[model samples]
Target: MARADHWSDTEIALTVADYMKMFTLELAGQRYNKSAHRRALLKLLNGRSDAAVELKHQNISAVLRDLNCFWIPGYKPRSNYQEALATYVEDWINSHSDFDRVSQAAVKQPAFVPTGVEFSTLLVETPKPSTTIQEEHPPYSPNRAASKRDYVAQEARNSALGSAGELLILEYEEYRLRSAGERTLANRIEHVAQSKGDGLGYDILSFETSGQERFIEVKTTAFAKETPFYASRNEVSFSADFQDQFHIYRLFEFRKSPKLFSLAGAISDHCQMDPVNFICRLR
Candidate 1:
């Protein structure tokens, strides 16, 4: 195959299959070497270079992101993928009978406090939105039954996962206060969502080093950093109402090694808000 030629259907299918295998292993917590996988995959491709294979894997990550599914952590999504790649990815998902079951199990799995966490590097910069020109409609579209299995949304509703993330942040906040020699403030930190209720829009009530109240909301995902999260209209409004006080502590890859990025001030300023739910009353 010429270097400039578009990937053949066979090549795309093989590549997508290889990517899915690695993704499944990562989700299942099984040990797998990416280098080894890439070496093996390269043998099957038509003289594709290592760099080409790497970019293709990143393209698969982009496709998975659009599908609202978990992707390999090592491969940061590259949005400049060919439309045919998206079609091949959707074909793989549709043909695999166990894809939904395996993914759902991974997303819905309960989480616990990860040990030996490096808090120093836990806080990362929030991801900037992609500037790529998206198509009028995405090329990959899941069938009706498959569309019902929205893994990202399902993960958002996982109370166990959400609680585990909140507890992690709660401890981090206390640590932050105590490390700054504010023991009294650390003691005053409250898991208000647990003590009070979930309607408060924020999960934990913490404090700034200057002794101001800091309201925190936690969103957790078992996937890569760029995975989109759901927020309530109430939460958005509350963040806008108390922009200085509100913070979003996003924890990702919680089932494995956990790391987080925080978005402060109004949530809308940090994220592009979308309305995903509705209320209906008899008129």
Candidate 2:
């Protein structure tokens, strides 16, 4: 089977449509088999190999990430995608009105505290910095779908989802203390953000096994682990101030199988900071 240097427009369209179908199913809480979808897509993709098709899906994920739109978790965003990929992605979103509606509702939807998770096994490694050097994809245009609605940021600000995630960690922190034979400390755990209001920089206040203070800021998302989250200057500053005590519990896939990774010390130390919002002053 011969392969072309670039996927033709029709092939890209078919692949994007297939990916979106699975994405919609995932977001709607309906069941869809990824392998089955892949097999079905392979038939229409112009002699593209299995690996080639998978890479294209990942490239599409990268495009969606740039647009601040949610992508399928199974396909992590692979950078250096073809420029045509971005244009086709934009076309898909522009043509599909229901895509925006469904994604918006998914993020705004309320959440409940996740239960039955093995806290011990829930912690996973944080994502490492990308090593890619050359930047191929263009910067987000003002006309992009993400500029219209940032689904990732919306998920970040969903109070119900935020609270559910914070509470989940609050319980886990208490459980951790008690399991470590610090029942007294467990009883002292406080959801500071809930008790004292939101400006404290951190959400939950717990203690380490040795009774040391642990200040946690929890950021939850219903999407994949690599999904970007929003944070305030106050929270970043607070983490730097209390580096020893500060911890960020990033909970992802909250509505489904919930898991998290802990980032300790300053937030700036772990991830690149982007300024999204600004306050204006009259001169």
Candidate 3:
């Protein structure tokens, strides 16, 4: 065993990297729920915070999972990172989900893959399973289906009052994606959603002038006046909990042409955010 004091910074970072990969595997369903996983991690790392433990291990994993990643949760829960990441990579292109197109998109265009010291050490403890795994095909799969069905779909469905309410939302994504890719806007307004490895919710991201990062949970609706969108128990709690870093991006004028006006900071940071459904209106 490498003595604690003797572990070089690179080695230590690698160790944390390994832990992150394992955790991502766990999120992916890799199956190492050591009876005392968190405790064991703390002991192993000599006492690091849970978030730090999570970040250190799988920073990219967290990002992919948090915002809409290649893979979304699917019919069968992910058992390991490889399978989970594969699901995202494949995008359940083969599964019967709302975002078959999106899933297939990821499969065709693979994004992040682990590398160098991070890659070798992380794979060390991962178990190779014997059971034959079932994955979705090229354009439709469980991961994509589950993601839309489980999380974002219902809200979208409920808010889709008519054709106009509908077209704007889908178009808005295209609009944002196109806009985000612009060389000018890319640096200033980041839209990449960090994956929610632990299911903490939010869909988009923005950076503020204060050198602070803001997580924007976008809500789009065709409701005539201000519309209210449903948030998960986790989403609401996360906003209320992280009073400083979170904000709500209300996309109104969605039917005509999508327009966004943000309610920056916690539900209360600006004014009282009624405990009722999160309403989409101007500042």
Clashing pairs in 1: none
lDDT of 2: 0.88
What is the overall TM-score of model 3 with all chains considered together?
0.31
Using all chains and alpha carbons, the TM-scores for the candidates as numbered come to 0.92, 0.95, 0.31
The worst-scoring run of ten residues by lDDT in candidate 3 lies at: 117-126
TM-score of predicted model 1?
A: 0.92
* Native-to-model Cα distance after best TM-score fit, residue 15 in candidate 2, in Å: 0.9
- Which one is best on TM-score? 2
Instruction: Give the TM-score (vs. native) of candidate 2.
Output: 0.95
Best candidate according to lDDT: 2
Best-to-worst ranking by lDDT: 2, 1, 3
Q: What residue pairs are clashing in model 2?
A: none
- Which scores higher on TM-score, 1 or 2? 2
List where candidate 3 sits over 4 angstroms from the true fold. 1-155, 158-185, 188-198, 268-283
Once fitted onto the true fold, the runs of candidate 1 whose alpha carbons sit more than 4 angstroms away are 129-140
Q: How many residue pairs of model 2 clash at the backbone?
A: 0
Residue 103 in candidate 2, Cα distance off native in Å: 0.9
lDDT of 3: 0.41
Residue 100 lDDT in candidate 2: 85
* lDDT of candidate 3 over 216-262, digit per residue (tens): 67665422113334556677777877768886666543323344455
